[model samples]
Target: MTAITAPMAHRTRLRLTARGRRLLTAVAALPAAIALAFAVVSGGAALATIDDGAPAQSFATVTVSAGDTLWSIAEDIAPTADPRDVVDAIVRLNALDGAQISAGQSLAIPAEYAP
Candidate 1:
């Protein structure tokens, strides 16, 4: 008769169980979630940054009335601006050859200026 022998089971100290595998997966996913949130929050901020300071504001359009001069209009558009510069802007805006005034003519006034 042949002798019967049972196979021996080997032990491993570094083996991972199901729980350890689940823990590893969770740890890996945490950073991905945080990175996704960061991307969502920060995406639009750079686009809004100063493209040479946010494209200066849209110029204001005004209907000229009697007694209104280029100096007055420029002051109204940008009170802090130098009068000469304002005059130049107004001249360029309206394409005027001279400082002539008329009623009911519309002119574009620039606002929120920077050099």
Candidate 2:
């Protein structure tokens, strides 16, 4: 008589509970959260850096006239320099909104063009 044998084809699937899934997700996100926090904390250090090596710039004051524009002022102040460069310097020095300047507005000219 031959003995009958069962075929070994049984497979088991691994399943995680809701709490286990949440714990796994938290573990996965912890490193990314830590990295973001570290970046934010480290970036704050750059904001307060003071450059003591550079000397404070000196500026010459000029009052705007009724028809004076940045281009015209730039040309009048620095005839030897490029008007665009002079205009950009003037705008940056005065923190102007644009090329617009009202009458009687005092503007600070860069020291390079001071005369």
What is candidate 1's TM-score against the reference?
Answer: 0.44
Kindly list the per-residue Cα lDDT of model 1 for residues 13-97, writing each as its tens digit. 8988999999999999999888778767998454455344333365667888889988887777677879889889778766799
The residue ranges of model 2 lying beyond 4 angstroms of the native Cα positions read: 1-57
Instruction: Please provide the root mean square deviation of candidate 1 (C-alpha atoms, Å).
Output: 14.3
* Candidate 1 off by > 4 Å: 1-57, 111-115
Per-residue lDDT over 2-109 for candidate 2, one digit per residue giving the tens place of the 0 to 100 score = 999999998989999999999999999999898778768987443333334223567889999999999999899999999999999999878888887899999999
Q: Cα lDDT of all candidates, in order?
A: 0.75, 0.85
TM-score of each: 0.44, 0.52
Measured by TM-score, the strongest candidate is 2
Which candidate comes out best when scored by lDDT? Answer: 2
Cand. 2 TM to true fold: 0.52
Which residue pairs come into collision in candidate 2? Answer: none
RMSD per prediction, one decimal? 14.3, 10.1
